[model samples]
Target: MRVRRLKWAEEFLGSAEVVVQSPQDIKGNWNTYMNRECIHLEIGSGKGDYWIKMSDMYPDIGWIGMERNESVAAYAVKKSEEAKENRKFIQNEAMHLLDYFDKEIDAIHLNFSDPWPKKRTTKRRLSHGNFTSIYKQILKDDGELHMKTDNSALFEYSVVNILKEGFSIEELCVDFRRETHDEDAISEYEQKFMNKGNPIYRAVFKKVKEEN
Candidate 1:
């Protein structure tokens, strides 16, 4: 179920032509809809800098940006009004990801996600065991989960929790910005954080289905 680019991208993605009104209907068909072999989903795509830039940098790969905050989602949409090809926006929470995508996602990107530092709000973190359970279901067997954040505590928590969920840690870097990763884009917010001597932690967790 591909969304037709009707008018120029509007901020309210629900009514915008660039967003899928009913993403649930597009489950398992996102790659087909976007006409790309691989699809990457960016959860909590605040302000859309990473989503917009990544889509531009990788036109051959389908990109789906998900942001629950409609206001923030709008900002990202407006900024990338013309970069609609191989891209679609979703204005919904990540919990409903199962309703919108099956085990079809090639990769998932979690960038500068909320730390949810409070001990009681641990489950609210995007990389919590609960969320990783969902990620396992939506991701392909060989899919990878790429996460980056400026919060050290959150990074440690995520690393522990993700491993507890049984995902394999394929790559882990304490200071992601220290290296020149041309394949990965650094958002303005991230660059500014690095300028402040803040180190960005990044990890790549991979999944491999067990052979029967």
Candidate 2:
């Protein structure tokens, strides 16, 4: 999906308070910037609605939105600034997450990530074994990962990959609204899917210690 480039997006993102020019500067010191203990990361944060809302909902926790597209990321950064939330937007791809962050995240939110359904592109999925390995490195030993999607195939694939990577599934819901409505955070894409009567699948996986 090619995002339409906004004329002032570059300028806006550069000056946006929530936009991080170089995440490497913060590295493992993210808590210092937010002055908070719990930090959560949202991968493929499209327009930042979910994380921005989450920041408002959970003031005690710091939020980080990661996106590769500058145009959409600009909107997220601007929104975070306007909300005065403890949230930051990083304009970078999820694959290089380790390059910017160390073992600093308490939880990860994967909301409406790309399915990458093709067999050849399976490795590109956010929940793939390769990406899960990277996530483990940057996440705490007991860190949790929450994923929501409308694609059942992608959800199933993610379940298999997540378990294969040694994470235990704590919660699984084929219809998130029915199973976990109270805890659900509706994102832009999630709202669209819900309006169309699509059932959302959600899962929470926690990292468990491996026995020697």
Candidate 3:
């Protein structure tokens, strides 16, 4: 996802009010920051369509969007310049997620993540075991993970890895867009995929609390 550098992108990243400059410092106080009782996080939030729209749809919960790319993150913030106080952006990668959150997140969203469709790059997939292990540590007991993708291979890989990593599937949909899903917002990539007749796959995995 090489983006042609935008001149204003860097400037916005430096001063965007919605961008959390030091997310780690607010690690355990996310709810306090958003003034919401529940919190949701979206990793690999490319271009911010889902992030911004989801926040608007669910105004009662705290919504945080994380993206490693500075320019892309800036664009997301720039697009939602008047983003509500319930939303925030972390300009960082998934690997560093634990530093910014505790085991208090209510839900996590993975929307059209990079498939990293190569044997050598398997570790880079957001649903990989390594990332799931981090997710397990940071997600509260019973917290749910919601993932949607147009790639069948990636969808299968995520299901296998998530189940292996101590999660149980609560729901699965092969052609998620076939029926009306007014509760969820369609991403820019998703709209394009739907227009091309691609089937969307969605899964909801819940953290299985360790038995005492």
Query: Model 3, range 115-189, lDDT digits (tens) per residue?
Result: 999999999999999999999888988899999999999999999999999999999999998999999999888
Q: Who is ahead in TM-score, 1 or 3?
A: 3
What's the lDDT for residue 19 in model 3? 88
Per-candidate Cα lDDT values, in order, are 0.86, 0.86, 0.92
Off by over 4 Å in 1: 1-11, 210-212
User: Per-residue lDDT of 1-212 in model 1, one digit per residue for the tens?
Assistant: 12344344343565677778899888878888899999999999887889988999999999999988766777778787774778888988999998999999999999999888899999889998788999999999899999999999999988988888868899999988787998999987788788999989999999757567
Per-residue accuracy of model 2 over 1-212 as CA lDDT, tens digit each: 35789889988878777788889988989888878898999999988889888888888898988988888887777766674457778888888888888988999999999998889998888898888998888888799999999999999999998999989999998987865565557877888999999999989999877577
Top-scoring candidate (lDDT): 3
Residue 90, candidate 2: alpha-carbon lDDT: 86
Q: What's the residue-level lDDT of 84 in candidate 1?
A: 73
TM-score of 2: 0.93
TM-scores for the candidates? 0.92, 0.93, 0.97
